[model samples]
Target: MRIIGGKNALDASSVHPEAYPVVEKILQATTSTLAELMGNNSKIHSLNAKDFVDEQFGLPTVNDIFKEFRKTGA
Candidate 1:
């Protein structure tokens, strides 16, 4: 491997061939879990990302969001 650059930067290259098999196995395991959790709906998904944003992030209601930033607050 070669490392080059100043304190503010660096460059990179490919990993050794021997490491790919291990990475492939790890990826295979993750795919099955990902499929089960993220695919086919499978009778789940009662709520989604938008629901999370509305529930947790709490939409500030157009008025609440821009209110103070606008002349309303002024």
Candidate 2:
């Protein structure tokens, strides 16, 4: 769920198209770093890294965009 009354919540600059590339790069680096530190534990590693990104940057799943589109089409 989204933060209530949260600012900086949008697709443009809040999480823009351009920034996706950078974010992916950072996520990759983060995963690699964690894997190196924690070793090959896929479940724990993925969850930990995902939690970090979600907490810090807020990762939007495919459903988020689809929901917005559905609402706007009305």
Candidate 3:
């Protein structure tokens, strides 16, 4: 799902729009679709939060993203 009038496609998710790039990076690293990641705690757990860290999104943000994935549902 996407935000009705939002610029960032990730706005519909628990993840913030400003963190879109972080989500993109996570997807690329995991080679998984958004659908595949959502609500998949095991898969999300497999990921290393540190690996996804960057200047914009630090370890806490990445960990938050992982938390979002664990709880987000369709």
Evaluated with lDDT, which candidate comes out highest?
3
RMSD of each: 19.0, 13.0, 2.9
- For candidate 3, what is the TM-score? 0.81
Query: 1-74, model 1: which lDDT tens digit per residue?
Result: 52344221111212233332432332353363322323234312332323223332333332122222122111
User: Candidate 2: deviation at residue 17, Å?
Assistant: 1.0
lDDT of 2 by residue, 1-74 (tens): 33434452334223344344434544465564322323233432344324434433544542232233223211
TM-score of each: 0.24, 0.26, 0.81
The lowest-lDDT stretch of 10 consecutive residues in candidate 1 is 6-15
The list of candidate 1 runs beyond 4 A from truth reads 1-14, 32-74
How many residue pairs clash in all the candidates, one count each? 0, 0, 0
Worst 10 residues of 2 by lDDT: 65-74
- In model 2, the Cα lDDT at residue 70 comes to 29
Two-way TM-score contest, 1 vs 3, winner: 3
Give me candidate 2's TM-score against the actual structure.
Answer: 0.26
Which residue pairs clash within candidate 3? none
Q: Please state the error at residue 48 of candidate 3 in Å.
A: 0.5
